[model samples]
Target: MSATDEQNLIEVSGLVSHYGDRQVLNNISLDVRENEILVIMGASGSGKSTFLRHLLGLKAPSAGTVKLLGRDITTMTRRELFDLRKQIGVAFQGGALFSSLSLIENIELPLHEHTVLDKDTIQIMARMKLEMMNLLDHEHLMPSELSGGMLKRAGLARAVIMDPRLLFFDEPSSGLDPVTSAELDELIKQLRVALNMTIVIITHEMQSALNIADRVTVLHHGDQIFTGAVDELHASSDARILNMIHRRPSRHGVDSDYIDQLTR
Candidate 1:
């Protein structure tokens, strides 16, 4: 591979996915460079979530390849895949912390499961991550005790506790007030610089995408319609892109034949 290719932390080429008879992704391709934040945005049912799943190796693509940290996931053995996951972290939209576990325990779970670290060492490491997220004082609290923004930060703390090389966040700004969402955006950027990690965020919030993304990729019905800098995205005259930016309904009306196929 060339040096530029070597620098890519994540690469997806001609990826396709299907759910039963329905095709969710239509030949997508993208690259995420090291320490860069790439935002994937699309309306609901636009396959952004499906694409994230494929990237995470939660689901295999029907065709093409996904490479992460110079490894082709499609060809990796189960054991190899398991090892690959240790270098990656994911923060779900709802934080996905276990209610029964304290914040510190949640962050330490990965260290305990993935490494042979002792209890004191693990607690220390987890607390360090909590400090990074500014949640050291709340480490003893359950998920229910935190506010929405705190929960998101706590999830992020757990995600980066292992010092992952790549981080994926699903809708980090979802369900947050404007000020809190902006704070989260700043935190994401800070983490990338502090950890030197490649970050991928899947979101529909246009403001968040424009603010945090070094590059933005817009998905329309599973197809990658746009991938470029925020200014280019704003300058584009494409109807789909404009509709997405302006929050207008899709111009492509659904046809009756497609509806019939869905029913059948």
Candidate 2:
């Protein structure tokens, strides 16, 4: 890839975070190239979600910086940050759709809230996004009416309703069966190609990571242990990376209790 190909759409430098005095992220740095699907993987409590909050500007990093499209979001004025957020979209874990609204309404909410478009126009755009996510027929369905996979697809539809340049997904396949999860993985890849979206995914699913990731960053103990292409991750000889890829047992044939406690 050329230098321009590596040009960053998102950059994090020396990131740090904490809950009270318990440090979570520590000196993290990473670059997300434009239009790339960069998967962030880690064991639970590795601070992946905390890092994501910083990237979304929902939580300020305790130290260091998070820059989006070359602007330091942590330091941006509220107006500037709001303007920047309009270009990005996030699909939080569990879909996070409005429980009271139908799929169409959920998707249209962003347009209604952020743009000056009339309801009819917003409805048309929302339908288009639903179609893109293979969810045209589910437009009128309420969140409670959809299956786990459908809920995820609906949330994805909502996230892309504005045709965002960058899309963030947290645990895209959580609480899903393998077959459905694999289908969702294929959909994610399709969306990226069709929309040319830069995707940042926070996931612990090794299969999902291997299937759709163009590049993967592995976090451990609040620090990055690996950041490279999927092939590099697979070929790496690093003990932590190897164990993660293979889902191997620890030295005692059992992961640490805290680590072993994570359900997914």
Candidate 3:
């Protein structure tokens, strides 16, 4: 392996997955460098979520391998995988905070579950993360009491509360105004520098991708059509990439036969 490849924090090779007989991911491969923010972009039903699940070891691949933090997850035992997950963190799209829990409690969940730290220590750590996200005051509020942007920030605070080496974010910009989205983008960038983390963000938001990504990977109908620097993505001559970037509708819309089959 080359020096650069050896530096990869996450490496996926020939990844293939299926939902019963229907293939969802076709030979997808990519590498996420340590301390770099890699953005995975695709339209709905493009296997972006499936691919992310594979990275998290939530699903097994039909073929190929996934190596995370220098360990092959495909071969790891359940206990081994669980232990490995302690160094990783995920922020779901919906925030996924418990309705019954306050923001501080929600952020404290990971530290509580994973470590034997005392309550006071956990609270201090959670509050530190909350302060980092600019959510110190709202730590006492419930999930419903926060706005959409605040919810995203709270989710992010929880994700990084453990000071993980790897962090995953799903749709961080979804359901936010342009200014709020931009703020979240800046926060993501700052977190990478401050925490020295390798981040994988799954998003369809063009501006968010361009703003925070050190490298961008685009998926189309389960195939990885493009992966490169943001400028390379913009300067490419590929029609599909251009269409996606430009927000153009597909020339071939929904198939009549598929629609009929679904309806029937």
Candidate 4:
């Protein structure tokens, strides 16, 4: 094996995915190294979320290989996938906490379900994770009682409760104020060093992507458009890449037919 193969926690090669007749990902390939932060960026409908799902083995691709920790998850049995997920963590966009469960309950649910740790030990471990997220004080609060930032933190606490070697976060900055978003970005960066984790984040926020990404993979209409360091992305001359970075609308001229219809 090459040194790159030895270091990568995730390796995708020529991945093609479809939802019925609609293609969602097209010939995408990327590698995520151990302890690095890889941010996947694309606008809505760009297939980044699909890419993230493929990485997590939540959906099997129509073709190509997705290897996580030296095993191809695309071909893993159900039981094997379950075992593999024990070493992976995912924080969804909405926090996805049960409204009926309190912060501590939500955070410790994984342990209670997956392990044989005693109640007190589970609570301690959960509390430690909450403390790391600066949420220890809100341990007993219900999900509905928390603010947007608080909810994200609570969800993050749960995600890292098991200290998974690979962490996948979806839109950590979504709906957050600038201050909260920046704080979350810092925390994400710290997690890489603190836990020695390989993190893959899915986001459309350019600032957040630039702030936390060790490397970035950008998609456009299901195609892998760019994959490299932030500096390289900045230097890219591609019109689509430039439009994304600058948040400009795509250049499509108004046709005479559309204008005539509008006049009618």
User: Which candidate should be chosen as best, given TM-score against the real structure?
Assistant: 4
RMSD values, in order shown: 3.9, 3.9, 3.0, 2.0
Per-residue lDDT of 187 in model 3: 93
Clashes of 1: 0
Candidate 1 has which clashing residue pairs, if any? none
- Candidate 4 residue runs with Cα over 4 Å from true position: 253-264
Clashes of each: 0, 0, 0, 0
lDDT by residue (tens digit), candidate 3, 11-107 = 9999999999999999999999999899999998999999999999999999999999888999999999999999998999988899999999999
Q: Can you give the lDDT of residue 160 in candidate 4? A: 89
For each candidate in turn, the TM-score is 0.93, 0.92, 0.93, 0.94
lDDT of 2 by residue, 1-264 (tens): 347535888988899999899999889999999889999999888899998999999898789999887789999988999999999989888789999898899999989999899989999899888887788988888899998888888888888888899999999988999999998899889989898899999999999989999999999989898899999998999998888888985575466786768865
Predict model 4's lDDT versus the native: 0.92
Tell me how far the alpha carbon of residue 166 in candidate 4 is from the true structure, in angstroms, after superposition.
0.2
List where candidate 3 sits over 4 angstroms from the true fold.
1-5, 254-264
lDDT of 4 at 65: 96
lDDT of 1 by residue, 1-264 (tens): 899988899999999999999999999999999898999999889999999999999999999999999899988888999999999999998899999999899999999898999999999999888988889999899999999999999999989988999999999999999999999999999999899899999999999999999999999889999999999999999988898888887646668788999999
Give the whole-model CA lDDT for all candidates, comma-separated.
0.93, 0.89, 0.94, 0.92
